[model samples]
Target: MLITKGYFYNRESHVNCQALKDAWVTLLSRYHWDWFCTFTFRGEILHPEKASKTFDTLLCKINRALFGR
Candidate 1:
């Protein structure tokens, strides 16, 4: 999937598999955060996690992992 702070992503986690296979989407921009960076795709946020994430939050977690908290 993708990570970003864009406020337009509203897909499911499992859908990424198909979304990738279909080539209907691709990582776009990156909302730079203190820790991680957000990845945007097709003007949408690509969090798609089971937890309550709004693309922005997912980006935070990604930051924590990649850049550390």
Candidate 2:
């Protein structure tokens, strides 16, 4: 199985990474609004990569919950 931002896509399919990033941003904004806004609005919040990883984890968990192993 191929995983992108924790969402699995067929390896043969050309999945856009931007779509996964967008999904991550949406997921954070929707479920973690306070942190999302804080991190977004805060100046010098120098951990975007970390946040991206977190988003990936969240997406993975969500995917597992929705689709199972």
Candidate 3:
């Protein structure tokens, strides 16, 4: 069985993307399964372009860790 959870933040909230990335990587590393899973995040980013870059980096890291690319 696979379990998935999502976290959302409002526009006025202050979010540390690096901290979030670290937490997610740690969680993924700790409890990863062979079955495919998806992670969806919904929140307000103060800088969409910057956040996009960060998320892209996060995705690459995740793929490399999970798939050994």
Candidate 4:
């Protein structure tokens, strides 16, 4: 089963970062029984460096939440 949620965030837009994080955590946890999982982000990232850092941080948060790391 594939679950999808969309949110737009940019310099001109307001988005709840924590809410987005929580949603991803919940989705991943709820589907923990699956043997494999993949996540894809399709959009243009204006700042590659900043986006990379954010992505790394989010991945760490997810890992800690799901694996107790």
RMSD (CA, Å), each prediction? 14.4, 15.4, 14.0, 13.5
Q: Write the per-residue lDDT of candidate 2 for residues 1-69, one digit (tens) a residue.
A: 666565557757756677778978887776634432232424555477877886778779989999997
The superposed Cα distance between candidate 1 and the true structure at residue 38, in angstroms, equals 12
Q: After superposition, how far is residue 64 of candidate 1 from its true place, in Å?
A: 0.4
lDDT of each: 0.53, 0.68, 0.69, 0.69
For model 3, name the residue pairs that clash: none
- Between prediction 1 and prediction 4, the one with superior lDDT is 4
Report the lDDT tens digits of candidate 3 across residue range 1-69. Answer: 222243335556544566678888898898858886464556854477776787789989989999997
* Candidate 1, lDDT over the whole model: 0.53
Q: Ten residues in a row with the worst lDDT in model 4?
A: 1-10
Clashing pairs in 4: none
lDDT (10s digit) by residue, model 1, range 1-61: 4544432234654334455544533342334336554544576555567234566577698
Q: Which residue runs of candidate 2 sit more than 4 Å off their true CA positions?
A: 1-46
Which parts of model 3 have CA positions greater than 4 angstroms off?
Answer: 1-45
TM-score of each: 0.25, 0.35, 0.34, 0.34
lDDT of 4 at 43: 86
Residue 50 in model 3: lDDT = 72
